[model samples]
Target chain A: MSGTFNDVIQIIYLAAASCFILGLHLMNNPATARRGNQVSIAGMIAAILATGAIVIHDGLITTTGWIVLLAGIGVGSGLGLYTARTVKMTAMPQLVSVFNAVGGGAAALVGIRDYSTLGSHVAAATSVTTLLDVIIGSVTFSGSVIAAGKLQGIITTAPVTFPGARIVNMLLAAVTLGFGGYMIASPSLAALGVVIAAALVFGVSMVMPIGGADMPVVISLLNAFTGTAVAMAGFVIHNTGLIIAGALVGASGGILTKLMADAMNRSIGNIMIGGFGSGDTAAAIAGPAGAGVQSIAADDAAIQLAYAAKVIIVPGYGLAAAQAQHEVAALADLLEARGVDVSYAIHPVAGRMPGHMNVLLAEANVPYPLLKEMDEVNPEFARTDVALVIGANDVTNPAARRPGTAISGMPILDVDQAKSIIVIKRSMGHGYAGIDNELYANPKTSMFFADAKKGLAELTASVKTLVG
Target chain B: MTLLTDFIIFVLSLWVGFEVISKVPATLHTPLMSAANSIHGIVLAGAILIAASANSLIGYILAFLAAAFAAMNVVGGYVVTGRMLKMFKRRTVPASAQAPAVNAGQNGGKSA
Candidate 1:
């Protein structure tokens, strides 16, 4: 390659990196987030184009190779387009998990292919990265798949465990590490295969114990793993673009995971145990303590909402399951028009993923300022006239305030602090934590049984007639 | 490139990434994760390199699969993120300005 061409390629890569940085900076603010996404897309296009130029100039690809490349592009782009276009907001977590699996699996394949092709001679540095890539990437691949399955309910949303689950998990990790060390020392394809197999099993064991409630943290952790694997793949290929991009993702994901764990007040260690109570209310209600649940009609609930001076709506996975974001938004609008102060209290881990409620609410065209985080909204719940919970369960449970419970020490919305609480739920079902929500049993709280979508629409209709 | 140089670049990039992402508001966390997911699609470059050099059938197959996965990460990530962000428009944006901007972006996106 000519010197100028090589320099040009490097310059374009540097330009792409800068764009990524600028794009992320812009994404920090909601007003500029769309532009940030556009900028990142531009960066991606530039990087791809530059790489293509390099490949063509070098005459590096054969006819068959080009065919393979095009075929891959076709398959990948088709799947991407379909999923991105058609996936519902509630299924976003599952989709993200699937994407993580693909990304991690691909990175692992890159390392494995390169390592296998390198016959007897293997440099220490290269071997290290190759082994790391295969181990981390394979783990991420399988772990993410399991996480997606659990989120989608293909696998039980409740934590799955056996008598010696922790011991088994430790054994799998040890074997994977042992294989990784052996592969690094011998640089043999056979040893590498063992490493990959063990790592994949280890990934499954690691995530299988975690229940549905902890998926956001698990997904974020897997996101970080995917990044590290990509960075290792970068080392294998000697590509700066991969290294920078991968490292960025790794660092960002790691921070986000920690932040999420902190928000729950449960260390990542505790959540990983996978049995944070059955996360089902049936198990919870069947336990030693039982309390009567007061039921209310939609009209009565609407009466409280319409007459209230301040209303705080708490939405959870139930609200998302029934696709009632629009209805809830409508209900809020109706209440606000009747001179009630309506705002949302979004728990950090409300839905399957982080910011799940925010995305759904944003979709309903809810004004951004009306949505408040747990910390910001908790204090206001005291002054609230009514705390209306829609399909929310564990997050609003008063049991979280006491020890010896599944969600003990976990931060909850101060819904119990409100003067009156109206809960809209399908039934007295256990939440993801499989414990009975003490909030439902509180004398001040009344349960209005209905699906989230139907219940919200009914509430909205009732509010309209009562106030106007 | 020397491994030392690469290590330096990797460490520096990690810091840059951490600093940039920390300030992102909670509301945009999903889109942030999605965008980062798209950025890591640079693995496609590595996949391409492998495919170009592959001589055997297994090599070609692995490289092709890797490329496909990487492409999916890139395309699906960016598109879904865009879709999510599309829903986050400020309620304050005047209807007239918003419509034309979206139309122009759609056309620009196709051509670009």
Candidate 2:
């Protein structure tokens, strides 16, 4: 009867796993995405309950253990709900990083506790997996924390470097490996401590030199690390569910990281090496000192927008920073009423995080069909009467097509091809690529210096009076 | 208990993951990350196992923390992703707001 009971529990786990697979499949379409989340939540609930049954059946948990587990669940649930509900769309990337950190930290602790309990009696296979779990998990934990800090503006977004930074990283790696090797050979608790410590420190150093601009890729990379660590923890405990889920996340995160890097026209290998965007240093080198830029008033810009046959709005990080998604959507709605065609042109790396702009725009109830990707919208720019570039700089730069520039070979929106161009920005500032936007100086382009939110509102007001 | 079985399962899951996830549109990347983050919260099972069997004070403490972290990851990731998706399904701005930017009523129900 007991054997049958265990088999039944395993079958439940299999069912939960299937839910996960189906849930992910449903997330491919916008119309079905919400239901996909619901299905995934149901699977999670089932997984949690099934795991609880297994633990209870083992009869290993003492009264104190039960109390601790209940308290943990309560506190964790409370914290999770609070943050998920309270966090703004702007801080979504940092929140994701924080989740990644905790996931990684928890996986490492599981491996550590398991290793300490087994000591010399642990099998060679388990030992190897456990050690790897601890290393990757610990690294992911610290690295994710730093990444979150950068996104939250708690830490400087500039690439923090020092003399012999590469050498220091190498030395840390060697020491971590050496300690890991010692633990494998002897199975002592002290060696394990050293391994964990070295790995944690290495994590911080690795992410510190990666500038804020490169954080989206870094977050994705750390996400993959967290998944691999979880898989390692699964191996230690001999749990197939954990292994499958972890492997899935690891593989998906890896692919997303590569795709993001390709979108930026940079290699994953180069990004991992760090020191790409050094913040102000790169900005100073390509500063906009002598560019011939023409500034247009809100009403003047409104004249161009109100009468345009077709307007393509290109939104970037500045738009997100000013929380102008709703404003832009409102403007588009206003224009559409006048029979002027409007659609958003989204560059792959436009926002700080992957799909950052889409999430923000979605919040404003922008129609799903109106948000167009780079390739789909590039050809439409030439036919557009007015290309309204809002707070987007680098991705619109013509410099990307030329060799020897900071953003050489990067894909850009064809805003310059439009018959007339209107740019809304705060001032003549460089974008994250730390370079000037060549499109800003084009004869066809006129700059309107203002915050994205204010600029959109003003233009909306102006169009109302002028067009009516 | 051959390690090879787990290895094969791991390798196969990776392929399945790549195939399934690559089809997700760019619009859902945030939700995709959140969903994937919750899936890896399966590590909570390992934490529960260790906690149930832990005999020492330190072991119990470590396991408790691990369980807490994993639980947060699972719960927070799902809730946040759901909330974001709910916004995606919200009705596009009401067609009645034909005036200029003065109509804040449509967005009044939502918080900043």
Candidate 3:
């Protein structure tokens, strides 16, 4: 391509990058978030078109290369569009995981191809970046697949571990980095191949032992890995656009990971270690506080809900699993008809991912303003007349406030403080944390035993029957 | 000097990303993530460039795969993020007025 044309392309890329930054900025608020996304798409389209123009103007592409390149774009776009359109809001987390896999794999390939072509002519900077790219990208690719598999139940959601799991993780880490170091010095294909293989295994081992509840943090971390790998790929290819976009995602994703982990009161280092058996110790330390629980019938629970001046509903993944979001919304509608101030208290890590419960509720046409974050909603619980918990367990557990429990230090919705509590549950099974929820045993708490959908439906009917 | 400029750009961009994205509320984490995912699809440009110079069999194969992956990352990423954000919009803005910023009502209605 000519110098003028390349300069124009670079300018175009600069404008697109600005769009991305501004788009993200606009995402800071719900009002402008959609506009932010559109702005970003405009930038991406410009960048893609500019790149395509470059390829055509360069006139060096073989006929076969063009066919493969164009066909690949067409196929990938078709799949991406199809998957994105068809995926349910509840399944967005895993879909994001799969997309992370694709992005990571693609970034790693960029590094791999560049290194293969370089042979021994690789500069120190390029070699280091390529090695880093391959390691991080391959890890994200394989790790995300395992995450998606776990979510979809293709792999066990239970923390899978062997006796030497930590030791194996250490060995995999050692091999990946040790071989990666050698490749940086020698620049050989075999060493690079070994590094990729080791990293892939490490990704699998690292994720398998992580309990399903911690997936939001893991997914955010992998999203960062995807960005970092692409940035490294940018270094290998000397592309400024790649570096900027990659670095932005890398840093922002890192911040989001920290924010979510902090919200759950989990340490990043602990999550990254993801070693097994901590639950046993935490369980032992916490001891048994749950007993003498009270069970309430649908009519009784509905009585409390119908007559309460203020009610706060706490939902979790169980609610989504039961597809009871709509039912809950209907129940709330009935409560509101009786002059109850019904709103939702959404714990950050309530569902499998951050904002998951909110998305599900919104999809059910729950008013956005009626939904509130933990900080904003916690104090309101003290003034609440009824705390109706449907299918949510760990996030509302009073035990989280005390030390030594599996979920100690975690921030929970203050449902225990409400004057009366009605819990809708299928059974007395332990929550995802494997610790019995302490709130259940509270004198004011009553477990209304039924599936969230069934229980909520019955409550809605009961409220209509009793109050109508 | 060129390398120095690239490094500077990378550092500044990282700072910019952190500053912008840190302000996003937890309610929009999923959309913010998918949006950022689309941004990194700049790798599609790199893949396209490589495809242009690809000569041998192995080069062509690598370019093809990278292009496919990058294309998916670019196209699907924007589309999904847009869908989720559209749902958010339905609530944030009153149902009376739709924002003109995203007029692709055909595509936006899928996930909404």
Against the true structure, whose TM-score is highest?
2
Q: How much lDDT does candidate 2 score?
A: 0.84
Q: Candidate 2: which stretches are off by over 4 Å? A: A280-289, B90-112
lDDT of 3 by residue, B38-74 (tens): 8887888888878887889889898889889988888
TM-score chain B for all models. 0.82, 0.79, 0.79
lDDT of the candidates, in the order given? 0.85, 0.84, 0.83
TM-score of chain A considered alone, across all candidate predictions: 0.94, 0.96, 0.95
Q: Model 2 Cα displacement at A23 (Å)?
A: 0.9
i-RMS of candidate 1:
4.2
Candidate 1 regions off by >4 Å?
A277-293, A402-404, A434-436, B92-112
| Retained true contacts (fraction), each candidate | 0.73, 0.71, 0.70
Can you tell me the CAPRI class of model 2?
A: acceptable
